[model samples]
Target: MKTEDEWQHCLTPEQYDILRKKGTEAPFTGKLLHNKEKGKYICAACGMELFSSEAKFDSGTGWPSFFDANKENIATKRDLNHGMIRTEVLCKHCSSHLGHVFEDGPNPTGLRYCINSASLDFRK
Candidate 1:
């Protein structure tokens, strides 16, 4: 496991904020929001595969949305911050905050893993 200082050293300010501090990036401003390539989305902090392009879709929520995820690489927790209850997604390998998941999504899984682009790194 990486120490807080080490993690801060390794990640950029935005990445550290979103992944380690559970901060959300601005809507419609994520770099991966419009990505439509075939690849894997891995955790920025730990490099664990999180989502695939096949499960990605435009949810129009301004974040990168996925119908499915590499379940083995993720974990969820109940978030009650800001007077709202939500499920918070994390990278299982490192426990880094990825984003949140919602029930409102397309068919098949009906789950939208609304993730932060700063919390991820793409690979083809």
Candidate 2:
């Protein structure tokens, strides 16, 4: 495990807040929110493959929406913050906060991975 100083040294403030402190970016304000590219979305903290371009879709939620995830790449836990029940998604390798997952999504998987762009890196 990395020390807080080490994580702070390598990660940006936004990334640290979102990934470590479980903060969220504003809706429709992410850099990759409208990205229609072909590549893999990797974890910013550990470079673990998280999502594929093919599974990405427009949820119109103003975040990076993916209907599916890479094999065993993420970990989820029940979150009861803000008087709402939600699943908090995290990087399986680094335990960094990636985003949340909801069941109201498109077919095949019916999952919406509303991810923060700062938590991911694209590799084309």
Cα RMSD for candidates in order? 0.5, 0.8
TM-score of each: 0.99, 0.97
lDDT tens digits, residue span 34-77, model 1:
99999999999989999999999999999999999999999999
Q: How accurate is candidate 2 locally (lDDT)?
A: 0.92
**What 10-residue stretch in candidate 1 is worst by lDDT?**
41-50
Q: Per-residue lDDT for 87 in model 2?
A: 96
* Candidate 1 residue runs with Cα over 4 Å from true position: none
Candidate 1 structure lDDT: 0.96
State in Å the error of residue 116, model 2: 0.7
Q: Check candidate 2 and list the clashing pairs.
A: none
**Model 1: residue 73 alpha-carbon error in angstroms:** 0.5
The deviation in Å at residue 34 for candidate 2 is: 1.2
Q: RMSD (Cα, Å) of candidate 1? A: 0.5
Locate the minimum summed-lDDT window of 10 residues in model 2.
27-36
lDDT of 2 by residue, 1-124 (tens): 8988899989999999998999998989888888888999999998999999999999988889999998598999999999999999999999999999999989999989999999999999
